[model samples]
Target: MTDDLLTRVDNGVGIATLNRPKALNSLNQPMVDALGEVLAGWASDDEIRAVVLDGAGERGLCAGGDVVAIRESALRDGVAAAKFWFDEYRLNAAIGGYPKPYVSLMDGIVMGGGVGVGAHGNVRVVTDTTKMAMPEVGIGFIPDVGGTYLLSRAPGGLGLHAGLTGSVFTGADAIALGFADHYVPHQRLTDFTAEIVAADVHTALSRYAVTPPASALAAAREWIDECYAAGSVTEIIAALRGHDAPGAQQAADVIETRSPIALSVTLEAVRRAAGLGSLAEVLVQEYRVSCASLRSHDLVEGIRAQLVDKDRNPKWSPATLAEVTPDAVSAYFAPADPDLTF
Candidate 1:
C-alpha cells in the first residue's frame, strides 16, 4: 500500500512493483515488511495463480538494503541494526519458500537483496540490463537473504569467487552460473509484462528478441575454481596473488578492497551454508552469524568507513587479515543469548 511498494491483481496474477526508483529500489524496513505481507497474502490466495515481481524504473530491479539506514541505525542503537538484518533475512526466506509460482522480472541491477527475491522464484527472467552480484563484502557485510544458498549452488568455486570478490555478472554469465533461468532483450520488457498479464507465460517466454553470446565470467571458470578453493580468505588472497595470471591478480584486488573481517566471516558463512539441508536452514544459520556480527569488531567500523563517512578507508579490527583470530571468527556463529528466532 505504501509508495515504496505497489501491489495489484490483474487476471489471475498478483504483481508487486518496487517503487523506489531513485534509490534503484534499495529495500528499507517498510519495503521489506510490505513485501513480506503481500507475498504471504498471495501465497494463500487461490485466485492468484502466479506473481510477477519487478521494480518501477529502468535502472534495475533492486540494489540491496538501504545501507545508509543501516549506518544511521548503527550510529543510534547498535543492537537495533542487528534486528534490522534479522527481520530482512526472514523476509528473504519467506520469498524463497513461497509456494506460489513467483516470476521475477530481473532487469537492471539485481544484486544482493535483488538476487534474494529473483533467484528463488519458480521462474526468473533476466535481461541484458541485468547486472547481478552478491557484493555484500564490498559493503562490509556477508551476503544474507538466502544468498548463501545461491552461492552454494554455483558451479564449483564460483560461489566463493563471486561471494568473496563481489564481481558483477552479465545476463549470460548469470545464467551460466545458475543465478538466472532465462535472458531476454532489455527493450522487450513491455511485451514480457504483457504476456505475464495474459497468464500465458510459457508461450510468451519461448520467443526471444535478442540474445548475447557467452560472457568472460564463463571463460575464467577453471582459474576461479582452482584459486578460490584455498582454506581461508587470506589463503585465497595469497593464492590469487601468487598466480601469474592477470585474472588472478584482478580477483586479488577485489579481495583486498573488501573489509577483512567481513570477508572472513562471509567465507565462513558460505562454507557453513553449503552444509545446510535447505534454504530455510541456511537462512537460520546465517541469522545466528549476522546477529553476532553486529557486536563483532568490523561491522560498525565497516559501515562507518563506507557509508557514514564515505571515506572507504575502514580501520578494520585486527587491522590485517593475518591478525584475524579463529576465536574471534567463532564468535560470529555463537548464539546470541537472547537469541533471534528468525
Candidate 2:
C-alpha cells in the first residue's frame, strides 16, 4: 500500500517485504498500518494460503521502531505517540492470532518492534546472520510489543537476564530461548521464500531448515537462572555481583548502565506476564507501562541520549536501582485509560 512496505500475491502465497532498506526497515506508523491492512485482507482471502514477511536490503529485517519519531511526538504531542503504540500493538495481536500460516524471515537484526512482527509469527525463520534482542531498557523503555509474553515464557530465568541486560541473541540462541522456530542459511533464504510461494509453507521451511550451532545462551543458563531468579531487581543485581563467574559480573555491570526505573518496572512486567495466558493480555499490560513511561523523565531523556544526541549518556531519574521506589514501579502497572482490549 505504501512504498515503505511492498506487498504482493504470488499464486496462493502473499508476500510482504519491508522496503525501507536504508533505515534497516525500521517500522513507523505508516509501515505498521500498511502491514496490518495487508495481513487483514489476506487473512480472509480464500486464494491466499499463507504469507511470507521479509525485509529488503543487506543489513537486516528491521532495527526497531522509529524511536526518533516517537520521541519527537512524545515531546510535541503525547497523544500521537500513544496512538502509534495503540495501532502497533493491535497489529502485533493480529499477527499472533492470524488464521493463515505466517512466515517471518528474521534474517538479520530483529529487535523491539521488529521482534513483534517477526517473532510472533507462526513460522519464525532465523538465519546465521540473524541477531535478535529486546534492547529497550537501554533506551529508557521496557520491552513492549508483547515482549513480556515472549520473554516470560523463555526457559528458566533466561528471559529475565535478557530483559535486564538486553543481550543480543544469535540464531541458535534464539531457538534455544524459544524466540525463533527455524534456522535457515542466509544464502538460501531467497530460494526458500520462492519455495514457500510455489509450494507449502511447512514443507518448504522444513526442507530448508538446518540445525543451528551450539547456543551460547544454553551454556550460560545455569548462571543466568541463578542470578536472575531473585525476587527483586536489587536482589538480582546482588546475585549477579556475588556470582563467581565473569559473565555474571559483566551482566551485572550492563544492568547498572540502564535506566533504574525501566529495569525495575520491566522485571515486574516479565514476572507478571509469566502468569498471563494470552498475548492480548500481555499487550494490555505493556500498554499500561508504556503510557506511564511516557510521563517519566527517563523515557525522553533516554531517547535524546541514544538517538538524538548520540552522546550515549542518559541522566536517569532515581539514578540508582535503590532510588526506584516500590510505589513508582507499581504505578506503571496501573490500568490505562480506555484500557487496551481486543
Candidate 3:
C-alpha cells in the first residue's frame, strides 16, 4: 500500500510487512493509514481467512510510532500529532475487534505504538529475541494504543510495574504478562508463517509453537503483587523500595527517573483502564489523556530529551513526585475537544 508498509496476499492469508528496518520500522502517518486500509479491505473479503503483520528487517517488528514527528508537531500546532493518534488508536481498536484471525509476529523491540499493533491481535506470537515494553513513561507519555487496557488486565502488579518503570521484558515475560500467546523461535518464524498460509492459524500454532522459558515476572510475582497493590503511585514506589525482592528496589529507582507528572497520570490511566469494560472504552479514556498530554510541557520535553537532542535529560515540570498534585494529574482526565469516537 505504501513504501513504509508492504502488503501482499498468499493463499488465504493477507500479509503486511513494516518496511522501515533502519528506524526499527517505526510507524509514520502513511504506514498507519496503509495498515488500516489493508485491514479494512481484508476484513470483508471472504477469500482471506487470516491476516499477519511482520517487520522487514531482522531487527524487530516495530519500535513504535514516529515520536520524533509527534515532537515536531507538538512543537508546532499539535494538530498533526492528535490526528496521528486519533487514526492510530482507531486502528488499534480495529485490530482488536477484527472479524478474522489477526496474527502478530512480535519478534523483537516491540514497544509503545508497537504494542498497539502487535499485541492486540488474537494470535500474538513471540520469540526469544522479543523485548516488549510500554516505555512511554520514559518519554513523558502515557501508554496509549490500548496499552492501558492490556497492561491493566495483566495479573497483579506486573502491569503497573511495567507502565511506571518503563522497563523492557523478555518474550517469556511477554507471555506471562498477557501481551502474547504462542512462542515460536525466530529461526522457525518464516516456516511457521508459511504453515499458517498453507493451512490455517491453529494448525500452524500446533505444529511450531512451544513452551517459552520461565519468566522473571513469574518468579517476582509474589513481591510484585504485594508492592504494586498499593492504591497510589507514591505508595507503590515506597513499597518497592522497602521490599526485599530482586527487582523491587531497582524498579523504584527506575521510576524515580521518569517525568513525575507523566508517572502520576500513567498510574491513574492504568488503574482507570482496569475498570473499563472493553478495549474501545479504554481507548476513549486514553484519547482524553493523550490530548491532555499534548498541552503539557512534559510531553514535548520528554521527546526532545529522548529523541530530538538525545540528551536523555528531560527537566520535567514537576521534578519530584510530591510536587505533582492530584489536580495536576486530574487535568489529564478532562474531555478532549477534538474527541475520538469509535
Candidate 4:
C-alpha cells in the first residue's frame, strides 16, 4: 500500500507501476520488498494471468536503485547495504524465473537497477525514446542484478564495450542485443497500454509491434568485437585507442573515466558470468562483488564525486589501470560470508 509502487488488476492482468517519477522511479528498500512480495503473491493467484510493469512520468522508466542512500550506507560499512542487496538480488532471481508472463514497458531512460527490473522480464517492450545502459563501473560499482549475466551473453564483444564504457544504447540496440522483444513507438504507448489492459498481451503486441530502427551497436560489432575481446581492459583500451574506427577512440575516453578498481572487477565478472550456467549463478557472483564493493574506498569516493559533491571527478585509489593488481580484483570473487543460496 506504499505510494512508491501502485498495483491493481484488470482483465486478469496484474499491473505494477513504479510511482516515483520525480526521482525517475528509483527503487528504495521498501519498494524492493514490496515488489518481491507482490510478485510472489501474484505467482499463485489464479485470477492473474499476466503481469505488467511500467513507470510513471515522461522522463523514464527508472533511474536506478537509491544510490544516494547506498553511498551513505557505504560510509558506515553498510550492514544495511548487504540486506538491501540480498532482497534485491532475490527479487531479480524471481523475476528471471517468474512463472507467469512478465512484461516490462521499458520506455525512456533505463540504467543500472532499471535494467534489473526491466530486462529480465519474459516480454520487454522498448520505445523510440528508450535509452538503456548498465553504467555501474562509472560509479565504482559492478553491474549487479544479473547485469553481468545479461551483458555477458550479448553478441560478440558488444557486452564488453557496454560494460567497460557504460554507454547508452537505443531501443533498436535493445532489441538487437536481446534485452527486449518488441518495439512500440512512444506515440502508440497510450493505445498500447490500453490494449493490453483491455485484452491480452498477444493481441496488443500483434497490432502495436513494429520493426525497430537501425542499431549502431549492431552495425559496429566488427570493430567492437575485435577491440573488446583483447585479454585485458588495458589491452582493450589500447586497442580502441589505436583502432581507426569511428567511435573507437570515444569508447576509450569513456572507459578511462571509470574507477580502475571497478573496471577491473567488472571486466572479470562479465567474463566469468559468460561461462556461468544460469542467471542464479551469475547473481551469486554479483552478490559477492557487490558486498566487496560495499566496503571499498572507490565506491565511497566515486559516489561522493559523482552524486554528493557533483564534482564529476573521483580520485580513485590505484587510480591508474596498471595499479589494479589481480589480488585487488580477486578479493571481489572471494566467498562472501553467508553465501546467497538459491
Candidate 5:
C-alpha cells in the first residue's frame, strides 16, 4: 500500500517500478493517478531523456487492473468507478503517445492492462519468461486501455483471435505478432540496464537491442492467420475445434470458458479499431466502447462468476454469439455529446 509505483533516476534515465509485487503490480486507481502525475512531470523535463518501466515481482511486469477495487467502487458509487476508468484510460493514452524514448523490460507475465503500458512503448523488450496477452474476455470485460488499437494492427487475423479467445502467448509470439520490439534473455536485463544507465542521453540505444535467435512462432504464422481469419466468433470457434494441434485445443478451451458477450464485443472492438484514422482516435473510440461496456454488457456478471463467486460458469447475457444482436453491439460505438475525447 505504501509503495505502488517507485520512481528513481539512474544517470538521467527515469525508471518507474510498479512495486505492488503481491498483486503482480496490478493497476489500481491510486497507481493510475500516480502514473499520470509522474508522466506529466516527465513530459517536459529535458534531463530525463529516457524512461524504463518494470515490475517488482518474479511473476511478471504487471498482470491486470485491480478488479476487486473496481467491483467495490462500483458497488459503493457507480459514478466513482466510471471516473476511475476514465482517468486510467487517459493515462494509457498519454503513454501510447508519449514523445520520449519509453522502454519496457517486460520480463514475465504481461496481460490486460499490462500490455497497454508495456507493449505500446517505443522499445518493448520481451524475455524468455514473458507471457503476453489481452485477456479481458476471460474476466467478462472487453479489452480497454487502448488495447483495441494495438490489437487491430497485429498481423493477419491475430488481433481477432487474441481478442476473442483470451489466449496466452510466449515472448516469441509477442515478437512475431509485433507486440514486442526485441527479445533478450532475462539474465541479460541487469547488464542491459547498466548499459542504458551509462549511455549518454543523446545516444540512440537501438544498437543495444537484442533479438533472440529465430523463434518457431514465425513459421506458424500461416496456420495462425488461416485459422483466425474468420470474421465471427462462432466461425473462429469452429475452426479452432477442427484443428488437432494442442495449442489450438488449449485456445479453444479458453474461448469456451469466457463470457460470450465480452468475446463478441472484443472481436468487434478490434475490427473497429483497425479502421480508425489514428492511435488517439482509436483510443477515444475504445473509451466510448469501455464506458458503454459497464452498463450494456455482461462485465458485472463475468466478474461475479470468475472472481466473486469463484464459479467459472458465467451466465452471459446473450448466451451465444448468434443471440448478440447487431443493434446491441452497435450501441457500444454510439457517440456521446460529452464523448470520450482521448
Candidate 6:
C-alpha cells in the first residue's frame, strides 16, 4: 500500500484511513489505487464483517482529488488526466457496489472527489464540522464521480441550484438533502469507529446518530425549487437575477463567476442524469463530458488561474452564458473512445 493510505483490520472491521493530512488528504492516483486494492480484498474477506473509512486530519475528511496533479498532467498530455479519471471512476463504482456494510466518517470538508468516496458508502456519517460541495464548475469542469446521480436525486431543484452555484452544504444540510445518512459529533467519531469494529454496523451507527441541526438548504428549498427549475442556464440566471430575495441575487452573482460552458454543461448533465436508472449509467455520461472538458480551453485556463498562478480569474472561452449555444453544449455528450462501462 502507498504511504498516503493506511489499511488494517481490527476484529471484524476493515479500516482505511486517508493519511495525507497536510494536503487535506486529497486523492492522488497512488492513493486511489491503494484504496481500490484494499477494498477489493476486504469485499471477499470473511473475517471482515464491516468497513470503516476516514481521513487523517483535523481540517476535513478530504478536500478533493489532487486537481493540481491532474492539471500538471493535462499540461503535458491529456491521456494522463483521462487515465486518472478512468481509475477514479472505477473506484467510485466499487465503493457504491460493495456488498459488505461500508461506513464513512465524514468529519470535515468533503467536495468533488471527496464526495464520491464518502457519500457513496452504505452508511455516511457527518459531523458539525462537515462542509461539503461539488464545486467542480469553479475549476471549469462538471461534477463527475456520480455527482450527477447524487445531485439530480435531491428533493425539488436544490441540486440544480447547488450545481450551478457550487454552493457549500453543512453537515445538517447534507443529511437533509439525502447526501448523508447520520450525524454524530466529531468528538464521538473515535468511539463510533471502535463500536463498528466490535458490533454490527446498524447497531453501532444507531448508537451514535444524533439529530442534526436545522438545515440551511431546507430553509431555502422553496427559493431553490422556484429559481433552479427553469429550462436552461440562461433562464435560471434570469430568475435568480430578477428575484427580489438576497439569496437568489447572491446565487446569480456566484454563477456569473464560473465558466459559462461548465455551468451550461453541468445543468445538461444533471437534467439527463435525472432520467437515468443507475450510477453506472450516469458515470458513462459523465466520462464523456469529462473527456470533452479536457479538450476545452476553459479547463486549462481555469486551472491555471485557480491553482498554478493563484490568480482566481479565469477568462472563459464562452465569456457569457448567451455565447454557450445548445449545439456547443450537446457536443459534450458525444460518446468517447473506449466508453466507460460497468
lDDT for 209 (candidate 5): 55
lDDT of each: 0.82, 0.92, 0.93, 0.91, 0.78, 0.90
| TM-score for candidate 6, residues paired by index | 0.98
Model 3, 127-171: lDDT tens per residue? 989989999999899999999998999988889988999899999
Off by over 4 Å in 2: none
**Top of the candidates by lDDT:** 3
Clashes of each: 1, 0, 0, 0, 0, 0
Distance (Å) between predicted and true CA of 116, model 4?
A: 0.5
Work out the TM-score per prediction. Answer: 0.94, 0.98, 0.99, 0.98, 0.91, 0.98
Query: On residues 1-342, what C-alpha lDDT tens digit does candidate 4 reach at each position?
Result: 578999999888899999999999999898999999999999999999999999999988998999989989988878788888888899999999999989899999998888899899998999999999988888899998889999999999988888889889999998888889899999998888788888888998999999998999999999999999899999999999899996999999999999999999999999999999999999999999999999898988888888899899899988899999999999999888876776
Q: Give the lowest summed-lDDT range of ten residues in model 1.
A: 203-212
Greater-lDDT candidate between 3 and 4: 3
| Candidate 6, superposed: residue stretches over 4 Å from native | none
Give the per-residue lDDT of model 1 (tens digit) for 239-288.
89888889999999988988787888889888888888888888777777
> Which residue segments of model 5 deviate by more than 4 Å?
200-208, 213-217, 243-246
Global local distance difference test of model 4? 0.91
- Over 1-342, each residue of candidate 2 has an lDDT whose tens digit, in order, gives 689999989989999999999889999989999999999999989999999999999989999899888888778867877888999999999999989999999988999999999889989999999999999999899999999999999999888888989978898989988889999999999889988987898778778999999999889998999989899888999999999999999999999999999999999999999999999999999999998988888889999998899999999998998898999999999998867877
In candidate 3, which residue pairs clash?
none
Cα shift from native, residue 192, model 3 (Å):
0.3
Q: Report lDDT (Cα) of residue 212, candidate 5.
A: 69
For 1-342, candidate 5 gives per-residue lDDT tens digits of 237999888887889988899988988878888888887788789888888888997899999888766666655555656776778777777887888988888889898878877877888889889888888887778888778887888888777767777778788778877788887688877767777788842233454556666755556666667778887778888888888777677777878788777887788888888889776787778777766766744777777777789877778878877888877878888774356665
Q: In candidate 5, what residue range of length 10 has the lowest lDDT sum? A: 200-209
Query: Compared to the true structure, candidate 1 yields what TM-score?
Result: 0.94
